[model samples]
Target chain A: MMKGNTRGTEAADGKGSGPGRFLIRARADTNIQLGIICILIIILMTALQPRMFLSSYNFESMAFFMPELVLLSIAMMIAMLTGGIDLSIVGVANLAGIAAGTLFGFLAGEAGVGGLGTGAVILGVGVGLIVGVLAGLVNGLLISGLKITPILATLGTGQVFIGLCVVLTGGPAIVGFPSGWTWIGNGKIASIPVPFLLFVVLCVALALLLERTSFGLRLKLIGTNPKAAVFAGIRKGRMILWSYMLTGALAAMAGILLSARVNAAKSDYGSSYLLQAVLIAVLAGTNPAGGRGNVLGVALAVAALTLLATGLQMMRVSNHLIDFVWGAFLIAVIALNSLSARKGL
Target chain B: MRVLRNSNVVIALILVAAMVVIGLINPAFWQLSNIFSLLKANVVIGLMALGVLLIMISGGIDVSFTAFAIAAMYLVVRTMVAIDYDGVILPFIFATAIGGLLGLMNAGIIHKFHMIPLIVTLGTASLVRGLVLGGVGTSNVNIDEMPPSLIELGRANIVTLERANGTTFGLTAMILVYAALAILIHLVLTRTMIGRSVYAYGADPEAARRVGFKTGRTMIFVYCTAGALAGFAGLLHSSMSWLANPRGFVGLELDVIAAVVLGGCSIFGGRGSVIGTVLGVFILVMIQNSLILMGIDMTWQRVVVGGVLISAVAITALRDRRSPA
Candidate 1:
């Protein structure tokens, strides 16, 4: 592992509450703000539809839907930690799912439609994970290796990945993941959905990795101050490359959950999730410039947005309007963060 | 080697080389009719690209222009249908004005709050597109409902060509509009005070501010002009296609931006010529249109475009690193 200056490494100390501000200023601690926002959304939803918003069924459904989004958001957050973004996350997710689903269909053949044996599902997942890492490696190569800007490199690769998906599927959905694979996305244990449990375990593990591990520390320090990190003998390029690989792997996990839940994979599925993930990451207080964010904030944001979206849909709002609301919500948070920051200044 | 230092020459050389190679492989590429069609195809994208060029020169990026274009086109056509109005100029003006207004929103947020243009535009893209589809209406304006004069305006041609095989391809006069705007932008950037300020600001905002340039005004002008251009391009598109879909140009920002960059405009702001951008747009347009003519799979279009963009950007990035500012 690359080590930074022992003294200046405090910036990469992985503080849940830190001074890396994306907007005008982030003084009130993002977690608290996100917590408040989540509570407010819940209160509003409950007030608007008491029975529907509070039902166990609603929570379960949201649990099933929220994991993929949460996973993607956290993936986005970590990329942000390097002061770089992975716009290719959506493309990676879709591609990973396509690879995995294709594997499933190939293995299952004609007679094995009901469910695949455990081994095939595991192998398929491994394939997906490898594809995700490869995609990320390509991104890292373009951004870090070729010295291209992250946004442009990722943007280009995203198109390539999406086009590959299109060419692979020939413009149709790939269906029929075995029941065993689907169980990871749908089944429950002790009244808790499998997806939600996985989400919890994975996110908490990520938090620990980011907070306690030196690998994650090097990444944040790279984001906080590239020159300083370089002076501190950090392997910046290798670290960034590995970080994107990690990011891709996380996106793949999200893709797997999504494909399992929907019982299919396609190039065009979850097109809108890209914008929402960006929105949630920003809302989670993940500074766009990097070095400040945590899993807790992202989790709260995911919960809030999911509830907000579900409640709005329950009110019979158009999906486009919900998108508008989310956009407005993002801008509103940005403005408020800035305005309050100005006051602090 | 010295000439290669100028990216304009580099881009122009690439464009010519591509044309020669493609024309060699498929002689149909150099046909006058095909060339004119490519020109016509470039008009809308060219206009949008010019606006984006200006913003790039001012050190900002906008992804919301496509949304702006669609909104302006949809809202104007919807209003035209409702009022039973059928005229080219009015819709043109309305679209441009609506686009300008939305551009003002972007400019305001960015200049006032000092926010990044990408995020600001992303928000507006969602907000504006959603507003149009959700709040206004999602149903498209049918051709029959469209104003006849607008359609006629789009159909106007400066010259008509009849091929040996009996196919007719008239060069749309919209190319004239595009050319006039491109020339105007060139003149403004080279000859006007505001344009110089835009370049200056993009080169270094702090230094420009120190030099007493109206940094805020320049930013506003750049975004607003970009918006207006996008608006006009939108109406032109609908007129050309003879329909209005609120969801059209959904992901065109990538193509337009790629074209602008491919043209030699620096994404980091400043240091790009209008001619460079024009050549860049033509190269991209040629690449896109030639694929169909060359019988390549349409699905490969994205991959090819993306590949071209990456290589182009990589070349620029590596060269810049070698001789960085």
Candidate 2:
């Protein structure tokens, strides 16, 4: 079965080897579709609320809010690339945030925002990164070593992580971080939001990692056909482990930004983001079966979804209605993708 | 000898060990009243687990059942309240029908699109939840507005025992209903042609198709059955709690799935039994009850449940590895 898929991908890849190669690659069609959808969304929003939709304030708010979604979608894309998923991203993000928040509280003392200093910020951020990566490593080991299915393994770990967070914070939000910590979340550099900039930098880095590196090639090959990958002498288990760990670290980074933006860390913060992240990754054209995804596609999807959400809010739509739209959109996209594939598109 | 080799036997042994340990820690755990209470509290989960078991056996999964249940039950209760109706049977019938229709929708989409069941169900889960939460407008429906007959049914107890202390325990009608459903499901799965088709499909879809089994119809039957059961569980849940809250069953899918998996129902599909699911439900409820009795923090319950699920999966995988194909 896997050998059949290898031949199919190879044949498809060969067909695209021509003069317009750079512009007409295998995924370019989906990228163009996404671009058109994004533009249509912008036009629709502008038509509905001409002033606010096109305003600088709205853009700034989107920039501020979109970083978390972008980072998470990227993390999700990496996992999906391995023909697996990391459902524990939300839990890991919140756990990492809570861990850093606790460290911040201890180092900065209970003197509120006044006692926070540079040392506290550095230490807290460092702790968050380590904890996040370690959590991902555990998920990797479960999937790769124990041979557990990715979905169930991460589902269990997600609950465990959230439970630990709840125990640590006793089911309340941890607040009162030093003012300096907000720099990562809310700060601006040359009028570009720091979080947004961080998102862009990560996107570029990941795009490089996924497209230009040998590791990236091997990861995609494994996803395309695990049996063929094994025959080619690739360490499938090790690749899966690293993929999950990378996702974990990225989730933690998003957590730090989230905590900084909200100025609090809670076990339940961003509980809704779990489903939304999956939606974005899928909408970005990351095949849930794995082996085909691009960072640029995910970034565009984030922008499109953020616009839709912001536009709906502006139109006085209830949050529940927005959720309904997202769910509908996901179904429509998947159905359309399947239909198009049947047409040999 | 063959029974001894079954994974369900190992699970049954584990359940016995857990019960013995809990009983040793607190003698009250062995009391008739406490056992009844445990069964009563877990009746809803057991019913849902049975439904999940069927779908899993057929190489499909429906995480959206909880959402379907909540929506069906809420709509039924609200309609009844609006019309000032006071019957017990009609509301249950309506809810179950609604649940089955929702399940049919899922089956239709999955069959038509040939999409992955897990992803499709995940999307539908969110879609259903969103529709209920948005369309219902009301967050909760009070029990006082429900039919007096249903409320009475909820309060009816068959065997009440008052302890020496200021506590009482009793068996409820809900437990009886759960037992009946479990037996019915067991019979259907083991003794019916449709059940055999479901198993064949799960074990190997291509082979089942080649054998001329109507895969689409089987999927529809399996999912609709699961949905109808979920609706029944929803009614039981609201009856017990005396309220119908749309958000009440939001995250309970994890528990249902966990229980089914723990019962030796392979997530890979085509390998499970109804009796095993019952044992899984009992073991989980017992663990939760034992933890409460030991005065442990409730937050730790999630950790323990999650840890047990992973460990169980690992052990099963290891056993499969050691056994020759």
Candidate 3:
């Protein structure tokens, strides 16, 4: 508590001094620790399995693994910044992917507009956004109109969304994604992967949304103190709802990209992202209970996860064991976040 | 007058009506065979719900209940199989003990660090599941290789009844376990001083402390008991399915939670009943079974559960506003 207050005081003065420097250092320590661990893992892997870790093929493999989660982490980062969480992001993404795939293959194909052309692509993108917006609207209404807790509301939505994905896909994978679609997932712009570029654009846009705009400022305040925000004439309900909707849209976009990348949209495609996305948010120092965290923190955390996963694969860790590792990392970071939050660090 | 005033009683009546309607639509549903089948599938989830009720009543949530159970089951089966432990009871004891330890760890961490229960449990859940998967290697228990004693415990039945359709229906031993647990929990929550203390802590920790209740200790006990129940549930899951899949209970914790909430337990802690939660579990399971029987797409199952959960919470919130405590 004392440390927390001291940090608060320093921020108030718009300056740093005394233990404030140490506090800032400790906060930055989150990023440093992640970077160091990531580097250490990569180094260890390179030494232990130089043939695999140093190969360009492995680098390309890492690229394939990074996009969906990176996109999810960013979506979750948006909601985390506003002091809310979008647990339904993975489910929403999966559903959106299914929606895009089904439209391209079944509905559009039946309508004779499914030829590998611009029209089918536009239809797919439109379907993704629509599904995303609808999913977000459900979240918004449940939290605002129904007054359900975000956790419970999203848990239900997650179930519903996944179930819908299953029903739409008939519990099978939508194979034969258009070559154009795969290109988006496997493509590059200016020698940079499209997904990576998308990540950059999303981070910049979200960072601006959170740090620069008055709405963003209001949201942070609302997250910090909803009652105070309401007293300050901010529409707390509307803002919270907006945050959830925005998260849904981002999740949908991620889903569309995931479908393009995987070359097949499966019902359970986004299930794995559920743990990783939330872990990224918390690892970025975002509080699960709302209020406090940032885009840079989330981005770094995503990079760490991508690197870690890649390193694990290079080490020839079994996929099942890798899942175990993922779960452990999530728990470790969350526990640390909780401890830090409680101790006012 | 009290009966009319009791929300549980009202909800129970509604459940009965729903059940009767379902039975009317499908007479086979009322057959002893169908009832037993439903009971078999739901017993584990029901037990888990009881555990969750304790946590919720104590002003906390245990998202890790399913994960804890999964880990406990994995450890118990793996250790037993490896050591060639000869008794059915040993496996259960081993599983429940592991669960209890995990629960205690959760209670200890939450109380000591003053952390949010949800986040802590969320992390622990993942950690526990990871330990299981990593240690056991994603494999299913080959129950066919199990000793006769263990199989007997898993498949044993009592209370067989001859139906008009000339089919005999028998209740599995698992139902008896669930019933015994329900009775024990109901008694403990209502008849014991510790039980009252749990309610007090949940309703208002500050006030309970002012009245000399050891709120922290009570919380730890609640969590421990929750863990034990979850372990038992996990064992039941393995027993009924005859396989302990490493994937663990996916979304089962949420269903347990939904059951607890539907049982009229407040999410805000301090108020819940084992009986209410048990009834809630049956209601939820019945809804799921009924929907499947009606040929309603399984996808809509989640939508309904979500809708019901939201509605239940909304109703509770509204009731609280009308009669603030």
Best by lDDT: 1
Which residue runs does candidate 3 get wrong by more than 4 Å?
A: A1-29, A32-41, A110-114, A334-345, B1-5, B162-167, B205-211
* DockQ score, prediction 3: 0.42
Q: lDDT tens digits, residues A1-345, model 1?
A: 111111112322233224445321442467777788788988998999999999999999999999999999998988888877778898889888899877776777887656678888889789999999999999998878987777778888888888888877877988888888889889999989999999999999998998789988888778777787899999999998998999999999999999989988998888888888888887887766666667888999999899889999999999999889877877887676556655654
Assess each prediction's global lDDT (C-alpha) against the native. 0.84, 0.83, 0.75
What candidate 1 gets wrong by more than 4 Å, as runs, is A1-28, A109-115, B165-167
Q: Taking the tens digit of each residue's C-alpha lDDT, what string does model 3 give over B144-240?
A: 7554556667778887788787977778888888999889989999999899998887777667889998878897889998998888778767877
Give interface RMSD for all predictions: 5.7, 4.1, 5.7
lDDT tens digits, residue span A1-345, model 3 = 111122122222221222545534654777787778778877877888888777987776666657678778877876755555677898899888888888777755654433577667877888898999899988888777666656667777877787788778778888867666777788888777887777778878888987689977787666555666789999877887888888888899888888888777886776768777877877876654444556777777887777777777666776667766776676566456545545553
Model 2, residue A102: displacement in angstroms? 1.2
* Pairs of residues clashing in candidate 1: none
Candidate 2 reaches a DockQ of 0.49
Worst 10 residues of 3 chain B by lDDT: B316-325
In angstroms, give how far residue A267 of model 1 lies from its true place: 1.2
Tens digit per residue, CA lDDT, model 2, A118-229 = 8888888889889889999999998899877777788889988988998889888998677778888989999999999998898899999999999998887787668778
DockQ of the two-chain complex in candidate 1: 0.47
lDDT score for candidate 1 against the true structure: 0.84
Arranged by TM-score, best first: 2, 1, 3
Clashing pairs in 3: A83-A291, B203-B270
- CAPRI-style grade of the A/B interface in model 2: acceptable
